[model samples]
Target: MKLARAIHFDESDMRVYASPARTGEWCISGGFEFSNWTEGDLTGKPRQAFANGWLGLETFGRATFVAVTALEPAELEALTDLLAEHFVTYYGAPSAEAARPVAQEEIGQMVELCEDHAPNTLLTVARELTESGVREAYRVIESSDAGLDQFAIHGSLDDEPHHH
Candidate 1:
């Protein structure tokens, strides 16, 4: 399988590319490195929303992705509203709750718990936690392909986790 990569700087900027996959579709994937967590830097941008310690949407195909950072509750609420708008626009009204930014600390605890498990296993656990609006808000967008699936979430990893 071929993978396409894209990076967004801050909240206002976004860039996407098509990969060698047969569908020629753009996939969304990203990770948060929360070495620096500050309120001013995160809330300065109009489109930016901080959850734990990272900024920007970790999205794919203009649909599903994660937003992890250390944002205030008000900021997270605003970001969730924005994500809902996007979800309605792209995915035809989310059957699930709209995406919301999650705190970096919550993500840290989850990762620590999964330290001994495989990466995919950890992802499954995290997905379960974010499903149906317990606390962390996440949306899973279905891909065009019949056999392939993509996932996105918002959180910070002390280090960049390798993607297989």
Candidate 2:
């Protein structure tokens, strides 16, 4: 299977995000973090995160970019468990048992997004609060041999140091 991992090009993510995700952590849209937001809340590092950051499953932090990568079933299961616990601890979910399916669905949404893209393809998300609710759009940047070097955040997807 495939999913996305956070990639950092510089310290911008660290500086701008109140809690920036560590490079190489698994990420998801994490728009759930902003479900209660209002136009008034759109003002600072939180605003920057709501604008485009991907949420890291490990740190519950924000990331500006993510790269598609292979995933093992065991790793996916582990992530699912971690996310479920997060919902209980942070969002007041009744229990990890009750939250597991929702957590899986969130990760599943990301899985579907990456499923169509090739490994190492970069992805970014943009969101805005609309009249009805939050709106999100994704941009995909497919990797190319000529330009891949530009994204030094990722050395080679096949390289061990970048995986994790």
The residue ranges of model 2 lying beyond 4 angstroms of the native Cα positions read 149-164
- For each candidate in the order shown, give its overall lDDT on alpha carbons: 0.28, 0.89
Tens digit of per-residue lDDT, candidate 2, span 18-118? 99999889999999988889999999899999999999999999999898988899999999999999999999999999999999999999999999988
Clashing pairs in 2: none
- List residue ranges in candidate 1 displaced over 4 A: 1-55, 58-69, 94-164
Writing each residue's lDDT as its tens digit, candidate 1 over 2-108 gives 11222222232332211111122222222222123333343442112223112222342221222221234564344345545544565456532533332323333
Top-lDDT structure, candidate number: 2
Per-model TM against the reference: 0.24, 0.90
TM-score of 1: 0.24
